[model samples]
Target: MDRVDRIRERKREHLELALTEASQSRRASGWDDVALVPSALPERSLGDIDLSAELVGHRLRAPLLIVGMTGGHPDARMINKVLGAVAEAHGIAVGVGSQRAALEVPELAPTFASVRDHARTVPVLANIGALQLIAQGERPALGAEKVARLVDMVRADAIAVHLNVVQELLQPEGDRVTGPLLPALAALVRVAPVPVIVKETGAGIDRESARRLVDAGAAALDVGGVGGTSFARIETERAGVGEGPFADWGIPAAASVLECRGLGVPVIATGGIADGATAAKPLALGASLVGIGRAALLAANDGVEAAILTVGRLIDELRTAVLLSGGARPSDLMARPPVLTGATEAWARQRGLLA
Candidate 1:
């Protein structure tokens, strides 16, 4: 296969394996250790709750984002269409997978661009890897001009620059060079017409990294923490290797959320969020939005209605969780602090995030 064909094959493999149980991390996301205090007299009813939230200057009916997961292959076109339709129907946000593949082969542009056709109103984020900001092998860095095509192709409301160092290290054909990424990111932020969101790819973001990203002009941060679909494991599997020590590595989702919170910009808690109750934890912990990855992907695979139903159920459960916690909105959960236990609490203590 040629280089473009190899990239397409890789993208197809990722889509197939991501939905399997083997791609999931065995470690806990720290949500299980968190318990919200129930109220005896929650005066507000579920019907009165408001799920609306704002991110990157766009208002959304719900604070849920269908995290970028697929693109660059023929099959990915329909998946993007389904996900985009679901997002538009629910008034939530959606993001496409890395547009690097399309940039290499213009023919695949339709696969990623399909999102804009259905998700006309909601915020659509265009994705690219941090490695693409620097030159690798014979390929030159994707400078300001090429990056603009990424946004134009998706009609993106924002750009999500994903940081996937671990995945790159494991993948056979991954970009191995570690150049001056911060400066490139800063330059991209200066030139891009839309907000630039720096996101992790399962390893999660720490307080120090979050600070630097914010300093580099990252409009938001997606703490794609551990305890979810682990790309490390996926790469290993693709390489014919079994799960290694790094399979369950990185900061858990809950702790990462605490670490990323208090920063001025909005934080998106991603990792292993599976249900509405689980999603509510991050929102209460100061995350402006929650991201659904494998679950949404699986639902979309079943078709548009399934995707909508799955998202609708999760949103309903989120509203219910907030109501039971004596809150009229999702943000109210922050005031009623959760009682943390297990490894999650230990992490918070060591990180000095817990007082």
Candidate 2:
């Protein structure tokens, strides 16, 4: 099959695999170890709590971002439309899956562009893979210019350069590279019209890598940590390779949030964030936003109205968590602080991320 055909097939497979009974099975997100301190006297009414937040100049009604999942297929048009409409109604941001396939095939552009068509106001992030950018090779400036066009294709508020080395290694068709990724990312950040966000695919970003990406000019970070969707397991299954120990690889989302804290940039805590309480823990760990992936995808599978209601329920849960924690606003939840324990605390200490 041709590149475009491969991209299209991959999208279909991803969607099919994502909605599987096995895919919906729970995985560890590591948030369980981070305990939010409860207030005996919250001193505030739940109705007064504000979930509003601002990121890269866009004001969100809530700090929840519907993370990128799929695109590059005909079915993606309906999915993006549903997700975009839900985001617009909820006043939150939504991201499209990697635009590489669409970029490779002009005819497929509409699959990703449909997002901008539906989400007229909220932040819409365009995605590209880091390895793909590096593979363009020798003409860094040219690659950056092409990425800029991708942003324009969707009128994206920000562009997310996703890092998925583990996923790539696991995939039979994956590319393995030993060279540096920062220089290429830096080149893209310099010329892209919108802010560039460096995100992990599933295996989370460590403090060292996070620092380097920030230095390379990333405007934000999405620590797509482990304990959520294990791409290793997914790809292995898709490849018919059966199960392996690599399925549980990478840092957990909670530990990743702690590692990336105090880095002077906004952190989006994702991976295994299913409900409001789980989402609230990331804020206390210094994440500016929380991301939901599988949960949102499952809801979207049920239809647009189902997706909206699902997201609404999560927001309601987050608000209740804030009130119970003595926070009158989403921002206040950050100040409440969480007690870190178990593997999460040990991971932080071992990495020198904690005092």
The most accurate candidate by TM-score is: 1
lDDT of 2 at 324: 91
Q: Which stretches of candidate 1 lie over 4 Å from their true place?
A: none
Query: Which pairs of residues have clashing backbones in candidate 1?
Result: none
What would the TM-scores of all predictions be?
A: 0.98, 0.95
For residue 143, model 1's alpha carbon misses the true position, in angstroms, by 0.9
Lowest lDDT 10-residue stretch of candidate 2: 135-144
- Please give the clash total of every predicted structure, in order: 0, 1
Candidate 2: RMSD over Cα atoms? 1.9
TM-score of 1: 0.98
Residue 242 local lDDT, model 2: 76
Q: Model 2 off-target regions past 4 Å?
A: 24-27, 136-142
